[model samples]
Target: MKVKSFLLTALAASMTFVACDNNDNEMGQLDNTPKSVSINLSNVISTRGAGQAIKDDSKVSLADLQVFFTNGTTLYKGKTVSGTEAVHYFSTKDDFDSRDDRVFHFLPAEVNKVIVVGNNGSKITEATTYADLQKKLAIAEQQDPQKLDLYKEVELTSVEGQDDLGHPLYKANVVLEPRVSRIEIGAFKYNAIAEGTPRKYTSIEVQQVMLNNYFTTADFQVGTASTVSKEEITAASVFGIFEKAAQAGATNPVWYSDVFSADKSADPATKLQVITLGVAAQYEHAYTEGNVRPAYHFFPKDDAIGTTNHPQVLVKLIGTKSDGTKEPLYLATSTFNPAVTADFAKIYVMNFEFDDEDLDNPQKCVEVTVDVMSWDVVPVTPEF
Candidate 1:
C-alpha cells in the first residue's frame, strides 16, 4: 500500500496571553510588565520516499494544549494560576474559534523559552521548575499510541504587529511529530503445495502473533536519540513482550509499543531477544490472500540488517490437509528487513507468504516482504 503525507494546518487563531503579574520567588526577578501575546501553532507530518502532500487534520488532532513559559530556568508563574490550570484545553476544533478559549495570561518578558505539549492527557500537570517538567516529559506515559504527539519551540519571536487591543503579538510555526512508529501486516497468503501431489492444503488458520525484543518505554523529549548501554540492555524493563489473540472473524489486529535502540554487540546473551508465539483457544479462522492482516506500532529501532537485535515476528498456524487431517505449524519471519531501521512517523507493511517448503518444515523461516511509507497517506490496494 502507498501512503501520502498530511499536514496539521496552523490554528486559525493564536493563543492569546493576557497581561499578568508573576509572584514565584524561585524564578528570581522577572519583568511583569503588562503585555498580551499571541502564539500560533502548526504541525507537519514528515514524509519519505515519493508522494504529494495533502491536508489532513485528523492525522494529528489536539485534544488539549499545555504551554510552559520558562526564564531559561524556572517556570513562569502567573498571579492567579500555576501548574496545569494555566494551560488551555480544546474539546473540539470549534474551541479554537473562541478568543476566550485561547486566553492564557502571562508576563511576556519573564519568559525566555516556550514548551508546548498536545494530547498528553493528564500525564503532566504540575511542575515547579523546567527541570521538573523535563523529568516528567522524559518518560512516555501509558496511553493510546495515537495521542502521543509533541510540539516544541525553543524560542518565540515577536511579530511586528500588535493585537486589536494594542498588545504585542508573538507568532511561531512549529512542527509536531509522533514519538512512535507503526507496523502493519497486510493480507496473508498461503501457497504451499502437497509434498508428493499438486494438491494443496484446504485451509490454514492463524492462532496467534507475537512481537519480541521491542522497547516498552520511550522518552517523549523531542530530538533526543535513544541509546542503551550493555548493562542497560539487560535490564528487564528495556525490552517488551507483546502478544495478541487473533479473532476468528476480525480483519486486522494491531499493537503499539515504544522505541528501542540497536544493540551493536554480537554476544548472544546480551544481544536483543526474540519472542515466540503460543497457540491458544481465543479464536480460529482460515486466513487467505484477501483477508486483512494484523499490525503493530512501536518506538523506532535501528536494528542492523544481520544483527541478533533484529526484531522478529512469530505466527502459530493450524493447517488442514487434503485428506482433512489437521497439522499444527509454526511460521516466523527471519526479520523485518530491507529497511531494518524503524523511524518515527513511518508505516511498515509486512506481507507474509508461506510455500510448500515452509509447510513441510515448520521450523524454517517464512518468506516475508516489507513495504514502508509515510503515515496518514491513502493506502493503495496490496498486490497479493
Candidate 2:
C-alpha cells in the first residue's frame, strides 16, 4: 500500500464548515432523486484502497466507464430544498483518486458542482467547470451558425466514467432547461448584484457541455505541465495563483513577520513580495473608501478546510443565554476565507477580533481585504 498524500503545514487559514460523517465521509443530500438510479460514472474501477479508508486530498483519476442518470432534467449545482435529490459519484482513476468515499454531495447550490469534462469536447460532467463550458459553447456557436438551431436541444449528462470518482465524473451534466438557452452569474452569487449587472451572459449551448469544478494544470502557464493530485497541489497551486494575481495588481505592499516565527527581519518600508500564507489571510481584505462586503467567517468549524478559496459562511451573533439566564453577552464577529496567497498587494480582510472593552470595532469589522496580487505561474524554487 504505497499511499502518497500532500503534506501541508497548516497555513494561517480557516474554513467555515465541516460537513462530513464518521468513517470520516458524508455529503449533502440531493433533492428529489432516486438512490437506485444514480448517474453512474463507471460500471467498474480497479484500485487497491477498496476497503482501506481514504484520507482527505487523496485523488484517483478514473479511466474507462459509462455514465447513467435522469436524461432530460435541467440540473444545476443546486438542488430542491424540500425534495429528495440524487447522490453524485467520482471514479477511481490513477491520476484522480477519491480522498474519502469519493461521494459527490449535492449541496443546495451551483458553486459546489465539481467540474468534469469529456475527452477534449466541451461536454462536461458534474465535475465540469462552468467557465470552461461557457468558453466551449461560445466557440461552437461561432463555428457552426447554420447548425445552431438544430443543436438547440443539445444537452449533456454524466456518462459512467470511473468508480467512486466515476459516478461524479460520468453522470454529472449541465442540469438546465432543454433547448432553452440559459446563463448565470459568476464569482459573486449575491442576487442583487446579479440582477443589477448585465456582464453575466448565458453560455452557448449548441453542443453537449456543462459547468463544473474540475481544475487542471492547464490553468497555470509555466514549467512542465503536469496534473498533480487535488489535495497534493490544488491548495498550493491556489496559493501560487493568488501570488500571481497579487503581483499583477498589488500596490503599496507590506510584509509581516512569519506567524511560525516572530522575526521582524524584513523591512516593512521596503516592498516585500513573498509573504507567508497565514499572515496574508489575516490581512486579505479590501481597503480605500467603501466596498461593502460581508465581514466574519464561521466554521463547520471544520479543521481540514480546502485550500481553494471556498464560499465562506457569514457570521451572525445569536443570544439569549441557554440556561434561561441573563441576556447573552454578545461577543464579537469574525470573517475567514481559506485563502492561500504567496504575495498580496493591497491590505486583505482581517480575522482577529477586538476585545470586549475595545468597542471602537476598528480592528476588522464590516470590511473585506481584496488582495490584488499575482499567483506563482511557476514554482518559486532555486531550481526554477
Structural RMSD, model 1: 12.4
For candidate 2, the 10 contiguous residues with the lowest summed lDDT are 1-10
- The TM-score measured for candidate 1 stands at 0.57
Summarize candidate 2's per-residue lDDT along 267-292 as a digit string, tens digits: 32221122221222431222111111
How many clashing pairs per prediction, in order?
3, 99
lDDT tens string, model 1, 1-384?
Answer: 111112111011123332223322244443455433344443422222111222222344455666667777786643322424443444434454454534455445667556666666654557757776552232123223334555554555534455555454555444555555544444345653444444345666654555554555455654333442121121132222222222311344224221111333433222211221112311122223222234444455454422544445655566776687987665556545454454554555555665556656634454345544544322212221
RMSD of each: 12.4, 24.7
How does candidate 1 score on lDDT? 0.43
Q: After superposition, how far is residue 90 of candidate 2 from its true place, in Å?
A: 13
> Candidate 2: which stretches are off by over 4 Å?
1-349, 357-365, 368-384
Which runs in model 1 stand beyond 4 Å of their true positions?
1-36, 41-58, 77-96, 101-112, 135-154, 157-171, 192-200, 223-293, 301-310, 340-342, 359-363, 366-368, 376-384
Give per-model TM-scores.
0.57, 0.17
